[model samples]
Target: MKRMKKVAALLLAVVMLASTAACSSDKSWAAKNDSLTVPIGSYIYELYAAYYSASSQTGDTAAGSASSQAAESSVLDRKIDGKDAKTWIREKALNSTKSLFVIDRKMKDLKLTLTDAEKASIKTNTDSSWANYKSTLEGYGIAESSYQLAAAEYSAKYQKVFQATYGKSGAKAVPDDELKSFFEKNYTDFSYVLCKLYKTDSSGNYSASFTDSEKKKAEAEFNDYASKISAGTMTLQQAADAYKSVDSTISVQNDTANLKTNLQGYPDDLVKLLDGMKAGETKAAEISSGYLYILATKNDIAKKTADEMKTDDGRNNLLADYKGQEFSDEISKEADSISGVTINEKAIDSYDPSMFAAEK
Candidate 1:
């Protein structure tokens, strides 16, 4: 649980950097179309999270070093994707926030109220998950109302979108075969042991140079570990457990529990590497700054049985995510096209990243 919290905070920062913001003393920003009111506090919290996360030289600090070291699909800097980093962040936040409003409006337009089970979900973070969250936020002196409002906004947006896209108030779920087919092409379930070699900043920028000695040193260390795995002497779990640090030593810092194939930030080269390998096989590929020796635990690219799809619950869940993503994408495109989103300078101008550091 402690470890999960650290990972959550770090990832939250990454998500913040990768994506949000509004301005005003009220800590709100408005969409010109009167569709949404973006929360300034959450927006700034995300910015600071990303800022401190990336600014750290090493993830060695329990909060950061390891958190930033996960293997991804694309290790590219998005700030250079066309717009500047700030612009990209703002655009994504506005679109996402507005999207929730749009979805919520749709729900009302349809005159739909969530079922009992659905309403119960709003208290999810507020209870045990939220208890911990509230305690942590209070430690930072953040107003309870601020984050609460943000959570409510997220809940309303998410639930409505899920209902509209996948739920039918009382509709029967799709058949298992149909879901299996959808899962087969669009989804994959796999676990891998990643050996990352790069020293990236919070923003994912790589080092300016690498020396031959460094390359040889990295290769020699990785080879030793790879040989152990190949010889079937040391398991990936054992490897990951033995050495948690990669910079000072080669270790299993990350492994995939699951991955959505079509998701962004997955390295295309790594995907290609994993594609050819079968389950329980170990393969090595030299990445930008280091070698990645992966053990493919489950390769689900092959067709799944009707049992694997597990019928309605799993299908509905995936469908919610799928439809939510599609809706988000549509909204993001619209956000990109929108002009003149107003931000209040006073609301978040004096923000500091250190205030919200997690309790040790």
Candidate 2:
């Protein structure tokens, strides 16, 4: 998970930079006509275009066109694929726009009550934050104020989330009995795994991209290990060690969870892969992270008195995180349903740089 987190952080940085750039081109639009403005979704596309244009500035759309075409190339080659790459990128762009809008909406609910010193400390710690935003916006060929407005929008959304969850009326609704049951059912078992996955080449790098043949080979290896354990021929540790010796692209680590806060929407295959298995069981086949393998172990389960679990202190300090996550998921679904939203696909399709007349 930590390794996955490292990848996530990098992706987040890229996304933030991209988002900032996309939101920063309002001034360019303004130059053409003082009253000119893009519709909501179109603004998102223009922002995305500016960001990509900044990264690959050939002054022509040729670079963006070529890159998008390559993502589609795998489909033409008969690789197991769905959707054209350009369409995929566009969808992602739209989803991103919606997400940003959601975030800003959430922010509008929260209040960041920080002391004077803490506020000052932000500059010392985050001096480069705005500069970074500015640079990214500039690179994406967007205007500075456009990016600033995007930032403000996101900030508003976050405020809303905080306010909605814990403002005036307060969001303290998770019951004592419910929290205790959740904790008991989801105790951490100090389990560990040593895993190896197939990659394109001999060099060991776990990439999201892999050939089908390589994927099969990796799955075959994990399956053989699981079979041996199931048959009682090889111990889980022994299997882990043996697999490690053969596969250089392997990682070993321990995992423990006191509460399954973020486990929702996780593929059932993954849950079952870890479920009901004792510390020494290896799973058959890989469900995720290429080829999956686990040397399961149970951690010590803490037993607390009913009163201890039911106290206000317990709910607030102990199980607050889990409760918050549960509430977030529930509220998000409700919001989606109430919004009665359908995407404007035609608007997205009609987006063209030529629509914006040139500056005088």
Candidate 2 lDDT by residue in tens digits, 6-31: 99999999999999777564333321
User: Clashes per prediction?
Assistant: 13, 29
Give the number of the best model, judged by lDDT: 1
On TM-score, the leading prediction is 1
In terms of lDDT, the poorest run of 10 residues in model 1 is 69-78
User: Please, what are the lDDT tens digits per residue for candidate 1 over residues 1-360?
Assistant: 999999999999987766553222344533334544555555553453443333332332443223333211011122334754344444444455445455556567667777776556555544544566665555544544555445664666556655555554423344445555665655555555565554656665765444667656655655665578778887766765554555434444333322445454556666666666665565555653344444334444443445444665655665665455665666557545544455555554554443333334
Error of 2 at 4 (Å): 77
Give stretches of model 2 more than 4 Å off: 1-65, 68-114, 117-136, 139-149, 152-164, 167-180, 183-190, 195-252, 257-268, 276-293, 298-360
Which portions of model 1 miss their true places by more than 4 Å? Answer: 1-80, 115-117, 127-142, 167-178, 187-274, 277-303, 320-324, 334-360
The ten-residue window of minimal lDDT in model 2 covers 29-38
**RMSD in Å for model 1:** 16.9
Task: Quote each prediction's TM-score.
Answer: 0.48, 0.41
